[model samples]
Target chain A: MSGADVLLLALGAVAVGAGALVVTTRHLVRAGLHLVVCLGAIAGLYLVLGAELVAWVQVLIYVGAVVILLLFAVMLTRAPIGPADDLDRAAWPAALVGAGSGLGLAALFVSAYGWRAVEVAEPGTAGLMGDRIFGSWVLPFEVVSVLLLAALIGAIVVSRPDIGAKDAKERAR
Target chain B: MIRPVVPFVVAALLFGLGVYGVLRRRNAVLVLMAVELMLNAVNIVLVTADTTVRAAVRDAGLTHTGGVFALFVVVIAAAEVGVGLAVILQLYRLRDTVVVDDLDLDAEPEGAR
Candidate 1:
């Protein structure tokens, strides 16, 4: 086993461990923090896999933006930072299903591959990624941008009430 | 050389853990967090596939398609989360609570308000 392989395994462990903590922890804030750790470790795994662009973008988008947004939502809702008695329900069923599927899938993958070595190519560079996105995948890229815009507008519409309605109610009073 | 199966299995487990959280957690925000974990798991699988395919094909253009697919998934996931959190915020405003059990899809009587 090379040093790089060892590093990859270690990072994978960190990511999986942190991910487990993200779900199991009682404190909401701590769960979010553990998510950060898991995401960071995933980014590290990406780095080890030689996808530098994906790794950095993972950090920037997942770590920098999404998580902060989550924290903001948590604070805005004023949810209990600590664990609540009723936060979890019917844990045994969920555990059985989750673990069973997880292990089942793992076993399937391991058995299928059977300790075979997969070739590791050069990490996809930004240049190559850009070419592909702009070249062959341009339409999907544009559609995603449009989707993001629609989501933004939809969020604003759903979260805010109509000013005219409020004004009319005030005038009636 | 790393065994591609390793990362793939880990991702599968992550997805499972995500499923567990989504089903067990009553808090809307925690459910969303669990969804994020699932998305991350998908990303790992996609990128790992890209690496393996790239190594086999030796064609730079064809191999990175997995990466591109993963990229789009990330973008969509971000948008989904944005809209989701907004909806959750609105729910909190209406009910003063974010527990999933408290939400009702059925219509109340006109005079209930």
Candidate 2:
């Protein structure tokens, strides 16, 4: 009914649609591109929901970094650029589960809050989010930074086989 | 005033689609992409919950927890992707294939024994 509500619905539709394409597309590279669109649309949904900081962060991280990483992986793995026939497994079970959960969850939500309107919160700006992150969330924030550092080191070690080969050989001996 | 159910439904459906993709995709990278979809759906739910529960949380002096959690999820997802890709690339190096079905979890490498 309201402008924000309308925007939310439209963006949600775009996101879901693009997400479908990201999954079902035959071309491997195109799936990555579709993921970018899907993520961008979700970012728009975040904006409409008044999460300005999260929305921008979604764009910067998901659309910008994650998708690029996926694309690079796809290329590095030498996925076929054209349509691949064996990209999908059997569909019946997947379709059944997908539709079951999707529709079932939708039904549950609708039944729980059918036509119930709630007041939107104040838009979350960067400053407010920053205060919360650096204030109460500072500990967890540092932990996450540590996690990132570990992941970085782990990635480097995993990718480069020579890093620990000597140690593994010594241990084996 | 937007209905909370709308976004909730969207997120649920997205998660379901993610489940399907994870099950259906043969490629390792595509499976990872599906996992990303599921994570995004969770983020949407978190942000929407922030709006719906803002009043109650503001009274408790803890506003924006959901949004902050969502941000943390983003950070975690980035890390997961980094490490996941490294593992996948290593698998590709070892086997020259990235198909999930081609991977045999129980089988030992030819020279390891």
Candidate 3:
């Protein structure tokens, strides 16, 4: 294995471990923190895989935007940052299902690939990504921007402070 | 040589953990967090597959397709979380709790008041 492969393996392990912690941790803030770690490691993995644009995008979107949104939601909702007695349901069933699916998928992958190696090509650079995004994928790119706009408007409408009043007025009629 | 299967396997496991969190977590926010994990896992697989294919076939057009797809997924996931958090906040406002178990699926809205 080359140095890049080893680094990729280490990052993957970090990602997997931190992802597990995101689910298993009792503290809500800590879980969010773990998610940061998990996502950061995944970004590192993306870097190792030679997708520089995706890696930076992962760091910016997942680590920066998404987690901050989560933290804001957590605080705004007044969710308990510390351990709550009822935050988790029964553990055994989840564990069993999770482990079963994980191992099953792993086995399937191993059997299908059987230690086969695929050569790593030239890395996907930002410039190439931009060209393609503007070239053929422009429609989807524009669509995503529209989606973000709609989501923003919808979220504001949905969470409006006057929603209860509107509901009450509708109910009275 | 970097085996493409390694990343694929890791992606699967991450997805499994995400499924576990979604299934077992009572907190709505936690479930959303798990959903992110699942999304990331999918991204990993896509990028890995893209790399392997590009290496083997050497097609320029097909080169960064998967990466671009993954980028779109990330963007959409952000939008999803934004809307999701808004819904969660609304639920919290209405019910004063974020626990999924605490939601009354069958309860009448009129009766709730």
Candidate 4:
């Protein structure tokens, strides 16, 4: 057990804790902040693992781009930032039971496969990762770009007032 | 002395807490946060694997797929945030609310069920 590992474990704990709070809370704004904390932790874990490229990606993509986009959308909608919104319903028992099973299943999977040790290679930097991503997974990588484009288009269509008018035109009797 | 196990345990615990939050919270935004938490927990494991696994059988000089997988996850997370927020925005416009409890596609309107 090295000092690096211990620090990571503790960071992981804090990250998880903050993330859970993000979900459980009723305030959407707070939820976004918590997500930042969670993503930050993941970045830390990436650094600890010696996957520096991945660590930076986590921060750049998640913290920098994704969360910022989320905040923008939230602000665009002008979501009531106060604690007025109801976070959950009265189905606490069912929710608890479902979540418990999810944890149980994950634990079972870990126990089943965890005992077997897999070989690990040394970690590399951004240059190595770039070669691999651009080399090995180029096809799926390009396809995902198209997919994201489609989603962006879909979002625009769904939210634009013109779409609403078009829907009304179709529905007009 | 205690290294791998602590981080691993912490990751698992984070995953558990994330699941609990997702199941319990009706807020869509919060649900997304929980999902992110779970993803982070997985990344922890991926990182641990990268650092800890024996160096011989692993190929490409990186033990775990941490770098590769994390990179993809980042891309996917971007797309997810984009699409998810768009949907949420549309829903808010229609219903004037962001509460997940208020959303129901199965209620079956005349045009779209």
Return the top candidate by DockQ.
2
- Docking tier of model 2: it is medium
lDDT of 1 by residue, A12-125 (tens): 889889999988888888889999999999999888787878888899999999999999998999978677677788899999988987888888888877767765666767
How displaced is residue B64 in candidate 3, in Å? 1.1
Error of 4 at A40 (Å): 0.9
TM-score of each: 0.93, 0.96, 0.93, 0.81
Please give the fraction of native interface contacts (Cα pairs under 8 Å between A and B) kept by each candidate. 0.74, 0.81, 0.80, 0.47
Clashes of each: 0, 0, 0, 2
lDDT of 3 by residue, B1-113 (tens): 57877788889999999989998999999999999999999999899888877866655666788899999999899999999999999888777888998889676544244
Per-residue lDDT over A71-159 for candidate 4, one digit per residue giving the tens place of the 0 to 100 score: 77667777677884467766577456645754675576567455343332455577777777777777877887888788788778766
How much does each candidate deviate at the interface, measured as C-alpha RMSD after superposition? 1.4, 1.5, 1.5, 4.0
Error of 4 at A128 (Å): 1.0
Please name the candidate that would achieve the greatest TM-score relative to the true structure.
2
Native-referenced DockQ of model 3: 0.74
Which stretches in model 1 have alpha-carbon errors above 4 Å? A163-173, B107-113
Q: How would you encode candidate 4's per-residue C-alpha lDDT over B1-113 as one tens digit per residue?
A: 22555556667767777777767777666666667777767777666655565364446543445567656666676677777877877776676667787777666433331
- Could you report the DockQ of all the candidates, in the order they appear? 0.71, 0.75, 0.74, 0.42
Task: Sort the candidates on lDDT, descending order.
Answer: 2, 3, 1, 4
CAPRI verdict on model 1? medium
Evaluate residue B59 in candidate 2 and report its C-alpha lDDT on the 0 to 100 scale: 58
For each candidate, what is chain B's TM-score? 0.90, 0.90, 0.90, 0.80
Residue runs of model 4 more than 4 Å from their true location after superposition: A98-121, A163-173, B52-58, B61-64, B104-113
Off by over 4 Å in 2: B108-113
